[model samples]
Target chain A: MTSPAITVDRLTKRFGAVTAVDDLSFTVAPGRVTGFLGPNGSGKTTTLRMLLGLMQPTSGQAIVGERAYRDIRRPAQLVGAALEASSFHPGRTGLGHLRTLAPQVGVKDARCHEVLELVGLSGAKKRRVGGYSMGMRQRLGLATALLGDPSIIILDEPANGLDPQGIAWLRGLLRALAADGRTVLVSSHVLAEVQQSVDDVVVIGGGRLIHASTLLEFEELASRDVVVRTTDYQAVETLVRERGWSFDAQLDHHVVHDVAAAEIGAALFAAGLEVHQLADHGADLEAVFLRLTESSDAPTTQFTGSASAAPAAPPAPAAPPVDGTVAPPPPPAPPTTGGVA
Target chain B: MIAALVAEYRKFFSTRLWWILAIVMVAYLAFIAGVFGFSLTVDTGADAQASNFLSPKEIAQSIYALTSPIGYVFPLIIGSLAVTSEFRHKTVTGSLLVEPRRSMLVVAKLVSSIPMGLAYGVLATVTVVAAGAPVLELVGDGAFLGDGDVIETLVLSVVVMALWTMMGVAFGTVLTNQVAAIVVVLAFTQLIEPIARVALGAFDATSEVSKYLPGAAADALLGSSFFSSFGGEGGGTDLLPQWGGAIVMVTYILVLAVVGRLTTFRRDIG
Candidate 1:
């Protein structure tokens, strides 16, 4: 495989007694969007800051290209970053801010205009950044990051404060950037957003990496709990009770245990039961995320986009099961670091 | 270095603060020169005003001399503003991230300050010259300062302003808050240095130490002729001799700038 565009090696950072990033390690390759997923204050920001060399890592190192970020002779052209949308001189126009950063990255001034247009900020380029709404600021921030045509882009919650259209625009932009063979590492708590945009996932909790893999792989690993919903809910639930199957109840529907769809279909036919739905329900990123990060006292989860990387546990065992039914044992998947997969 | 320098200049000029501050400096200089011009003209009268035989340089010098006291403040603002503004806006993080080799940026900031400081000095110098023209014409060419003196003064003014700008940079690095930097710079200029110098002067044993004080050093660089009366032995009042002041000031700037840049590398920007 080609060298990862970004490689963070056992990085650690501390602010006084609080350890922000603890021995975190990951690699983001080119041609893909790697979702750096974590909850708030979970060391995601600190790790990103260290990756860009905005903050000194207490130990370890972050490499962009072949060198550490601090050692890169022309960093802007190598790795473009947008950490905070509000980090700008309020009195300066958006165009002015871009112009200043463009030359530093060795890009032509025209690139600024091009990027402004790319991020849909062309019409507002002349406006002072202070006057911009958060959504507009985020777009402008993205434009700045793209100005240099960097080989790698690192954005911390770049989609924050964006409307649906803005988020969609950002998702498409990231995809296009990755298509051009650039590495895009975006950190956010929104799994759904990452679900829609990212190609790979790097999941972390409590300042530790949980797992890293392709998007589909992370989904399978993180959401192993099979959800089954049927209109003949009472009959199915009663059947589950008779068999001592444990499951969560739903409004207007019944969610049974990990019973395989094929087995359920045959049993329902044999019992002369008609069902509206018997499809196997896969876990959404939200459920997997909450399940993976549920230590009660765990740091507040900031959902940039919903994407998970660890295999989830089955529902509680106390509920009754239905006749001729057994939850399919987890999906046949690769070994997970922290969960049974 | 060129890329970083260009970036520094771009960031410096793109902000509204620089323009507004420039306007304020121009207005203040014009007002001061106007007052000096009128005074010199009224003293010399209309006959001298018509002959226009006066030396333009001396009139320019005296007008500039009166105006020079105010000159330091603006360049100080420029220096502090250049560095402190980045902290104020939190763009320092973005700037450093783009070029993590921060020492080069500090150097670029110092290099860029020269041209900017020169520009402000030229504006103030030209305003004094332009305003002093009528006064020179009125005072007779004899009262007009020679070109040698004018050139020397202008060059000295530029260098002095540049040094102060660098000093302000050091100050800004030492104190990231713009208001606090301004306050400390102002306090040093108005109170701290003066008090320190005065207190130091009272004791003959430590009087020599006062010459190296920041205020005295800056005063020497401006080629102020009045330093001898400030208690130092005639030649000692100047922290450095004619050309030595620039070298000394540059050294101070280099040392402080390096310290500032090193400090920045170790900072964990939030």
Candidate 2:
């Protein structure tokens, strides 16, 4: 019943003849982190800009906390953002920049150092921003975004250049922010990072919304196939075909299509084929992404995690297990699983 | 709006480029005074009786005139930097995100430039005037505070220069490129305006039209002193009356400012 933290309704933007964002509509709720995922040149940043009132939409409205960004009387105290974390004066020290922005945002002077410490940049607070590394700049940016103590935080590519430690730190920070019942909208091209950090996901491609769903629903809808591996793989394929079940043939396994793993196992056992390994491909979001983005010219055959469209790298090995502790099995199948043939 | 103005002020002062420009203006003033001091020493032979050559009021007026061209550069640079830094740093996205009413932001910037411009204008004038005091003492002529007109002229000149600086901000916003804006202003102020003004004097209609030029408004600040040496109503009439110059300057500022605001408010920050 509560109003969404961010509402973008029927938003559109045109640059000359090209429509960058076309009738895009979505809402991000409070108390959760929403990931805004899209490919490059897909108008994600443009949409964010419109939402923040940095650029007026051609037609439609964007509201943050029930009011337009322009109408927010004390904006910084209501919504904090880091659009470009590095857009700071090179000569100004990190703390000095915060101090300079403090009076304008109407926050207490002490919050400057408070946010600095919160972002783990307290050590580099006195250093000029020019000398800080990219990771340090990202932390400083997070500090600025948190300085106002606002209920809403928006960041674009917040993890673009972070090291693994920085990324882990950022993941924890976002989790903590959402835990405090605040709204967080983060945009990134990396689906894996978003999968790890956000509760909800809104996928956009070519400036249009592809899907908006909870992470569980997205994974359920996207993870569609099960791979069955057995020493009698040939017999299993024959049984699947004889039963009119369609599946992809692989080196040592069969990716049974449409039918469930239990159904496949029942059919295989009925055919007198002993199954050694049987499991669904463990939560590969890329398959769903490929199906969603699939078209005649679109490259869907190379679907894999992180390196989907990388031409020279071959296919991505596979998605890591969802628990984050285990790596996905190696490629060229071990003659017991159903995947590559 | 006030918050934005304050923020713009902070952005302006926080730059090392601004500090460097300030030093340049102050140093230029002192350097000119030093050169003038050298000239007086050579011309007056250091005798107390011939000290009239170093009259402080005359020297003050002369320094005010001689360095007038150089004094205008700071405000121009300040105005350009105020807008261009946003583009150069890509902070326009962050700033516009905070203050969505971008026209108000442009207005804030225009308002903010006034103080810094005033500081430069006042300081530049004061430095030249104050430094002239001792040099004039070396000449036999006594120092004259003169009437309130001197103070008024100095104050008005500073105010006019501040407006000039805001005009530069509008220029920066329209161009959105720091270097291009600065170059255009410098070229027009230093070279083109002077040439155009002289060429206009050859014909009465063009001469009258030239009064509306930005340079004409700048020259108007000095009042009758610009025509002091000539006879018959100082031998030259203003292109426009003094008030007309103010009107012309304000008009230039408003047109460019409105265009600048509209452009900035509508354009995508990225």
State the lDDT of candidate 1 residue by residue for A108-206, as single tens digits.
888999988988888999999999999999988888888777788999999899999988888998888888888899989878877788998887766
Candidate 1 error regions (>4 Å)? A1-3, A221-233, A257-270, A273-281, A296-341, B33-63, B131-143, B194-206, B225-240
lDDT per residue as tens, model 2, B1-270: 677777787677666877788788888877776565445434555433222543545544544543344466667777878888788877676676566667777888888888878887887777766665566555423324363655666777688778878888877888788778778877887778666766764467676766667766666655532322111231224556678777888888889888877775567777
lDDT of model 1, residue A11: 85
lDDT of each: 0.71, 0.71
Span of ten consecutive residues with least summed lDDT in model 1 chain B: B225-234
Over A101-176, each residue of candidate 2 has an lDDT whose tens digit, in order, gives 7766787668988999898888888888999888888888888888788899999889988998889888999999
* Model 2: CA > 4 A from native: A1-3, A224-281, A294-341, B33-59, B139-149, B224-240
Worst 10 residues of 2 chain A by lDDT: A307-316
State the DockQ of every prediction. Answer: 0.67, 0.46
